[model samples]
Target chain A: MVIQDLKVLICDDSMFARKKMNMTISALGINEVFEAADGEEAVAKYKENKPDVVFMDIIMPRITGIEALKQIIEFDPDAKVVMASSVGTQGHLKEALRAGAADFLQKPISDEDTRAILENAAKGVL
Target chain B: MFAQFFGGYLLHKKLVTSEDLTQAFEDKKHTRMRLGVLAINAGLMTADQVEHVNITQQSVDKRFGDLAVELGYVTEEQVDKLLSQQPTEYLLLGQTLVNNGVLSNAQFEQAINDYKTDNELTDSDLEGSKNESLNKLVTEFYHLEEASNARMLTDYVTMMFKNIIRFIDGDFTPLEAIVIREFDAETLIEQRITGTYDAVTCITAEKDVYFEFAKRFAGENFGDITGFENETVGEFLNVVNGLFAVNQSNEGGAELTMTPQQFIQDKKISFEKPAFCIPVVFSFGEVDFIVSTE
Candidate 1:
């Protein structure tokens, strides 16, 4: 698929974070973008939209990004969920990967990092 | 990191007013680091000798480095070494103050020496942003050594300053920290850290100052948008706390996680234990960071 045609879902509790990432993703030519304020909403949106790529935050008001990732993966084993969180500690990293996260991104994630992930997703590498 | 602490030290000593610092931080971007200030900072030349060179330059058309060398104040090798080094932000602030006539050359020399001596910072420590040096600087600046959880406080504060410089502005003067059991906050974003240890951290400031800080971090004009300030500042706290948790987990094997941020306005929040209320002054206004190790 073309990179611009891919649908992206961003799950972060902070409105500022969500807005920032949404703008960046939209600027990258991805028109269909979804946002979730918490992990529960993230899972709901993932199942509803079945976006091509998902960017998730670790900590949230409801179930965390990891829990949401597990739910999405269970619903669709081929889900490409990227754990984009501020806390990429060893424990979280291991847990996210063990739970079937496709990739991990540390927060304050730059536009370049997001672009690379989207490109990889478009190429079916992630 | 050193630059912020140095600015703090200058403020503490009353060498310059907060207004002076605000102006200097704004002007420092345009201020070039001169060889005289560099040599004086390096202890290679006396202020009097630098002054002599400055006076001689009025008549003799020569570069400061060349003039200093010609006057036998600094050798060519020393001048080269000083010139080769990158001017640190703190030094540039100092240079700007000097250029603005806010501080004299002799006063700058004394303040620099006293600051280095008081903080026990060596030349190497001042040059680069080494973690050890920064931890030491933070510990000393905040008197964290006297606290029971000195190591954790040092690590957290050091990380906070680094992130403040990263996400926010570096042009802030960290004021002294006050211990308080409770605070009536005008606007505050509070988040809790749990797992190996439990602690509460908060960022609070006045209304306009809070908005300005959010604007700086978000880089957006969310004019009169209710709750936008909370979200923006909450995200900043979350990022800093998340990074701190990750650092602790990686370095000390201490598993830590942060709760979702809580936004409080015109409310009285009390801590179980005494919290360190660290106030930092920006060009816009003052903001307070409160941390409670519970």
Candidate 2:
């Protein structure tokens, strides 16, 4: 799949975080980008859109990102969900990886990091 | 980060007025660090010597370096070393103040020396941005020693300022902190850090200042983002608190987690413990950051 053809889902509670990531991903020429403001919405959106990549945040209003990741992985074992969170502690890292997260990005995620993740997903390497 | 705290120090000492700092921070972007300012900061030449060199340069065509050497204000090797060094932000701020006539070279010299001595900071400390030096500076600036959780408060405030410089504008002065239990907030966003310890962190400002603070964080991406002022400000608080939590988890082996941030309007909020209200005056206006650790 071409990079631009890869569908992306960004799950973060902060409107600002969602908008910023949406803008950055859009700038990478990825035309299909979806956003979910919470972990529950993230799972629903993942099932609905079947996006190629999911950038998830740990802290949110409803279900935490780790639980969301678990639900998504249970639904589709091949899902590529990256734990993009502010709390990337050793405990969180171990839990996220154990929950089948493809990767973990500490926030304030730079545009370059987002772009590289998308490129890797397009190449089936994430 | 040192530049911002140094500005705050000068404000506390009455060496420079708030207006002086605002103008200097604005002007410092274009102000090149000159040899005289460097020499004065390095303690190799007094402001009087720099003024004397200026006077001598008016009569002769020689450069300030040659004249300084001829006048025995600084050695040729010292001049070379000063010129060879990269200008730090604090020195640039000082140089800008000197150029703008807000501070005499002598005043800059005295303030810089006093700030370093009072904080027990060395040139390398300011240059390299050593974490220990910053912790000391933050603790002393806010008088966090009197607080119950002095170490945590110092670490959190230090991280807050670093993030402010990183994400927001560095052109702000952190005013001294006041411990208060109650605050009538015009606009406020609060987040709780819960795990092992419970703490509340908040950012509050008047309507206009709140908007400006939000704008700084949102930047050019959210120009048409109507009614997102609350979200923008809340995200800033969230980011700072999140980074602080991560730092604590990594260094101290303390497991910390942040709750989703909430926005409040025209409300009165009280803390279980006395919260430190740190008012930082940005060029746009002042915003208060409150943190309570229990």
Candidate 3:
């Protein structure tokens, strides 16, 4: 359950934001990170890698985070998928948590949040 | 962005009182303006650096320093000295509000973290809340009409610069005293901008439109809140343009083409070209902003 040698998957539409998140997680030494452009790709990558942790943005083109979350969970009942969303996505957070996302990270992704989510992701696996 | 927009909505629905709404507005007003002052006070930029950029950006696509060089205001050496003085503390939304007593420092800090947790926002997501009507107008016009993804990127720029400038020269004004002005800057935007935009144009008595659209767009066409804001700023700019050009005759209409949005966070970064940009100052009730360019 521990993310030692953990593989991370980042799913979002913004290349700039995805780069920022990758850099932060990489700085934390969470190497072996994978990337997906939207919900469908995220679920596909999740299936391909079955990464220990996933950071999914709820509102992506094609399939949404919620739909993908459900799909990922269905594929792997223990899939650890966290969400990357804006603060305005408050209402959806409850639904995400209910839908089985491990945790959520806010936008303008920060070091503190990366640590928080990763830490929690470990807890979710255990 | 989340607080002001939601506070206004809650008030409108009578979920919260006018007092709560006013208090939040006052806090935002102080915070947004103070970030600029703090950036200046910290020597992030000299008065000349800011003023020179402001004056030049009014007419050029280039950023503050590019024009500073063109105008001989400061040398590259001086720019280096000033860049080191970035007001990291001041640029923080919570610190600005708390430091000014709009909210106690502790309270402001708590609210910000809570806001972050409550909203699950990334910084880029929060950046969308910082734009005004003009940017919104551009968002709609550029994204919808032109159908370019490039136009959608302005949210980050608007958020980062939302506090970059304020109407320091103006004092508090009421609804009766409020005035709206229009100008012709077609020569600078570099693109042939004709027609109207509307959206981010309405300041919502403060910067409360963030939540209004957040609520509206979250469940509809956009993804989640972050995705919603990511897309909204561009649309908002177009909406603002629509409202702004509501009455302009074609003969008197000003073409307002938008250049690609560039974010100059903390320090001054210059655009590479000259652009026809509009400078608009607005005061909604007692709040004020000096939007020189979108």
Which of the CAPRI classes, incorrect, acceptable, medium or high, describes model 2?
medium
lDDT (tens digit, per residue) of candidate 2 on B75-194: 899999999999999999999888888788888888999999998899899998888989999998988998889999999999999999988999999999999999998899999999
Which ten-residue region of model 3 chain B has the weakest summed lDDT? Answer: B184-193
Q: What tens digits encode model 3's per-residue C-alpha lDDT throughout B158-192?
A: 34223222212121111111223432211111111
**Best-matching candidate per DockQ:** 1
> How does the DockQ of candidate 1 come out?
0.80
TM-scores of all candidate predictions against the true structure:
0.97, 0.96, 0.37
What ordering of candidates by lDDT runs from best to worst? 1, 2, 3
- Compared with the true structure, what per-residue lDDT tens digits does model 3 show for residues A31-75? 789999888899889989988888877545688778899999999
Candidate 1 per-residue C-alpha lDDT over A79-121 given as tens digits, one digit per residue, 9 for 90 to 100: 9999998888888899999999999998888989999999999
Q: Which stretches of candidate 1 lie over 4 Å from their true place?
A: B223-225
For model 1, state the Cα shift of residue B63 in Å: 3.9
